[model samples]
Every structure is written in structure tokens, then in C-alpha cells.
Target: MAREIDQAHLLEYTGEFSFDHKLILEFIKTAKPDYDHTDPKTWPLITSAYLNKWLIKPYSGVLMLPPFIAYERSLVDLCVADREDGNVELVREDGVKTVRSRFHHHFPFIYNHNGHKRKFEYMHADHYTSWVFGVTGKVPATRTKGKDTPSASADPFDEILELIQDAQHAHKTDGATSLRAELESAHKDLDESKKRVVAAEAQQKLLDKELTHERRRAEGLVQSKKALKQDLQKAFRGEMEQHTITQKQLERVNRELADTNKLWREATNETIAAEARSKKLEKTLKDRDKDLQVSREQAATLQEQMVKIRNELKKGMEDGGQKRQADSNASSSQKKKVKIQQ
Candidate 1:
């Protein structure tokens, strides 16, 4: 349930109605120089005079003095409770405000004090976390004897009853002369009582409507908070799922990069080995060409020596045939001359 405002408690709790805490404490000490404010038992009794003296007339014509609050912290005039001007306003989460007026419980009540009927608000003091509502005034009331005002021992209710009996006796003794005036007074009092009752009933109906509206506002606030909590929970879950997927993709990419680096290292080693074998083959081909040129020069020298030996043999045979023919002709001539002479 949304709480209805307790005007007295709100007055004590809010600084708007009370004087400065330090100033109130100073006033308490000034009221009783020797009284121990720390000890509740020694604290001076509060009275209307002290409360009255504490309030200076406010610059605003509406200055309400403290005596307006009765000893019970209630409005001194209960019949005027319905006529108060207090209001309440509530602010919603969307920045809209609902205003209500004519709250009556506790008041800047009007009461008679200091020989003048003055407007008064509540007055309270604080001492080390404990509040001293000028509920106990700065001064105590002293009764002096021989006055029309009630004595210190008088019971006000008993006095009012006694005065009523005295009035009845006087009217009876005065006879027909006072009867008409007495009847008129009774009729006036009855009319005022009826007016007060009608006002009280109208105020009660207004209070009932305000209470229903406050209850609905409280229920709406609870539902809005529950819906906001659910939205935050869903958003957090989606972010966590997306974070998990990204982490898995990063791990897969790292593994693929490692495999590519391993293949690059293996290919580089094979290329180095192939280059070393090609250099060795080129050195062997150069050595083989030098050996083939030396073998061709030795074969050409042996062929030339064979051709010179054939030419020398043919010339020696021709010269020997010619010398043999000459020797045979000389022998034939000598034999023919000998035959002729015979």
C-alpha cells in the first residue's frame, strides 16, 4: 500500500517547518542555563509561553506561531480541520507529476496565544540525533492568584459544567424576561454543529478517492520494475553468446596459420638441396671437355708419321730396278761380239 502522509511525523522529519538544528539547541540552553539537556529528566518542562516567545512574526502576513499546535501535537481547532490548505504532489518515473490539495491532518494551525490570535507552525529542536520538538517550550507557565482565569488546580471540564448550571438557574429565576433569548442561543449552536458535520463527511469522501489513486500508482511501479529487469537479463545473454562465437573463430584461424608456416619451412630446405646438386654437375662437365681435347691432338700426330713412312719405301724400290737393267745389257753385248768373230 502507498502510505498516507502523517503530518506530525512529516513535520518533525522535514526541515521546511523546523528552525535550524543548531539555533534550536542554542535556544534550549538559553531557556535554562543550568538544566542538563543531555539528561531528559533534568530538561525543563515545555509550555505555550516559550513556544510563543520563540516565534517572531514572519514578514509574510501568514506567520503561524507554535502555540497553534495543541499539547497532543494536533490542531487546536478540530472543526477547521476540513478547511486546511495543505497539498501533496507525486512525481512519476516518466517525469510527470500528479498534484493533490486540501490535506488536513496536521496544520499550520491557528490558535490564540501571546494575548493576540496569531498563526503558528510547528517548532522542534534536535540534540545529538534526538529531536526536542518545542513541544516543550523555552518557558514554563506560572499561575498567579486572584484572576478570573482558572486556578492551577481547576478542572476546565468541571468548570464548564458548573457555568451551565449557573446559567440555567439564572434563567429560571429571571422567568419570562430571559426565556426568549435562551431559546435563540440554543437554535444558533445547533445550526453550527450541523454545518461542521457536513464538512467532515465531504472531506472523508475526498480522502477515499485519493487513497484509491495512490494504490493504483503503487501497483504500476512494481510492474515497470519487473519488465525492465527482464529486458536487461535478455541483453546480457545475447552479448555472452556472441563473445563465445568470436573466441572459437579466432582459435581456428590461429591453427590454420601455424600449418601454413610449417609448409613454408619444408619447401625452403628442398630448394637449397637442389641448388647444391646443380653446381656439382656444372664442375664435372668442364673437367670432361679438357680431357677430350688432349686425346684428339695425340691421334693426329700418329696419322702424320704413318703417311711419311709409305712415301720413303716407294722411292727406294724404283731406284733398285733401274740399276739391275743396266747390268744385264752389258752382259748381252759382250756375248754377241764373241759370236760374230768366230
Candidate 2:
């Protein structure tokens, strides 16, 4: 019977689920210690109730968003769920249906499987954090604020049940109560919730757009780096080719230098031999000139001796002729004296 009632309530709750800010705050404030942590079926009921009150019918303006404990600060968003143009659109996640609303990014949406038709808007701060975790998975740390609250010390669940009961009784049994006043309060709360949802949705859209632009810039930088590397490689290859050609030319010049050195050595030897022959010719000419000078002095001395002997011979002939003439004169005188005596 309890199971049947539970199922029946689940069906009804799913069909009428909507955001209700007051209900959410009340539930968190009044959660019992005995709220079954291990039961899967109970979780759906709890989640459906929570999402319905906060996301669909309650204040949809500002959502309280905190990071998932396991994921830590990594995945967190504050959302405003229901405003048009400023809302984050609902993108069907690959494996899951009814994820956060892509509309009004500031007010993130909550999905309850059992109450799939109703959408819930999260409060902009910690509220969105709780809502996201509740839908994706349960967060053990989160619970109602009531028993934890210092004010009314009582059984948490009973306290919440009594509060609901008293409110109902006040509306039904109390007479002469102004229905207009209560309706006005409800409308005011709903408007505030919607405004918060709009704000959160706007923030989420901005983040997505920024992330897309950053990715494109990174891709461009990578392409630029690749082009620079290719140019450097081409320049290095050209320099290597030039260096090789220069080295080959240097080797040829060295070979020509070696051949010129050998030719210089041969020419030096020939010059030394020519100088030796010239010195021998000079000595032979000096010896011939001294011999000719001695022969000329001897011929001049022999000619002077021959001229003195010819002069002495001529003087002897003149003396002999004078003696012969004296003898003739004497003979003539003697013959004349003999004739006169006779």
C-alpha cells in the first residue's frame, strides 16, 4: 500500500512540477535526519519535488551555484532559467535527456526524470550548484537547513509537515481572510524567481562564446609556428651547399701553390751554375793581358843593343882609311931624294 501511494504521488508530482522558491527554502530548512540516503526510489521523489519548486514555479532570477564536490570547482555556473533572448538554450546532452537549459545561462535549469515535462530554475548563487548536482547525482553534504537552524528544535520532518498543515488550515478554515493579499504575495515571489533565472542564462552564453574565440586563436598560432620552422630549415640547407663549394675551390688553389714552389726551386739551381761559369771566364782573360805586357818590354831592349853595335863598326873603318893615306905620301918623297943623289 505504501509503495502504491508512493508511485501515485510520483506520477502526480511529475505532471505538475514547477519552480517554487519558498518550497525549496522550506525543504532545505526542514529536511529530516532520517531522509533515506540509500534508497534510489526515494531520491527521485525528493529530486522531483525540489526541482519543481525551485526551477519551474519559484523565483527563476538568481541561482546559487557551487561546484560539485567530486568535480570540485571545475564545473559550476550561476544561472537564471526562464527569460527569453537572455536565456541559455536547452542542448540535449548525448546520453542524457533534459540537461540544464542552454537558455538564460544565469538561471540554470534542473531536470527530474520522473517529472520530465516541468523545468526548474536555479537560484544564482549556491542554489544552482545544488540543483545541478541534484540532477546529475546526489550530493551527500546538502540537506535541509531547519534542524540545523538554531530556532525550532524539533523533529525536522515533523516540523515541515506541521508547517504545511498549518498553512493549509489557515487558508481553508480561517474566515474573513483577504485572498487578494495572499495571491499578491505569490505573484511577487514568482516574478523575482523569473528575473534571477534570466540573469544566470546570460552569463553562461558569454562564457561559451569566449571559449570558442580562444580556440580559434590558438589554432592560428600553431600554423604560424609551423611556417617559421620550414623557412629556417630551407635557409640552413642553402648555407650548407655554399660552404661545400667554397671548400672544393680552396683545395684546388692549394694544389696550384704546391706546383709553383717546385718550379722556383729549379730556377734557383740554374742561376747558381751560370754565376760559376762567369767567374772562370774573368780569371782566364786577366792571365792573358799580363803575358802580352812582358813581351813588349823585351822587344824594346833588343832593338837598342843592335843600334849601338852598328855605330862602333863605322868608326873603325874611318881610322883604317886615314893610316893608308899617310904611308903613300912618305914613299913618294924617298924616291925623289934617290934620283937627285945619283
- Indicate which candidate wins on lDDT: 1
Candidate of highest TM-score: 1
Worst lDDT run of 10 residues, candidate 1, spans 124-133
Clashing residue pairs in candidate 1 are 46-136, 46-137, 64-119, 64-120, 64-121, 65-119, 65-120, 125-132
**Candidate 1 global TM-score:** 0.25
Residue by residue across 42-115, what tens digits does model 2's lDDT show? 32232323443544333222223321111011112222222223233232223322224333222122322222
Structural similarity to truth (TM-score) of each candidate: 0.25, 0.22
Off by over 4 Å in 2: 1-267, 323-342
> Least accurate stretch of 10 residues (summed lDDT) in model 2?
67-76
lDDT (10s digit) by residue, model 1, range 143-199: 222112211342232332333344444432222224334433433443333433344
Model 1 C-alpha RMSD to native: 66.3
Error of 1 at 12 (Å): 10
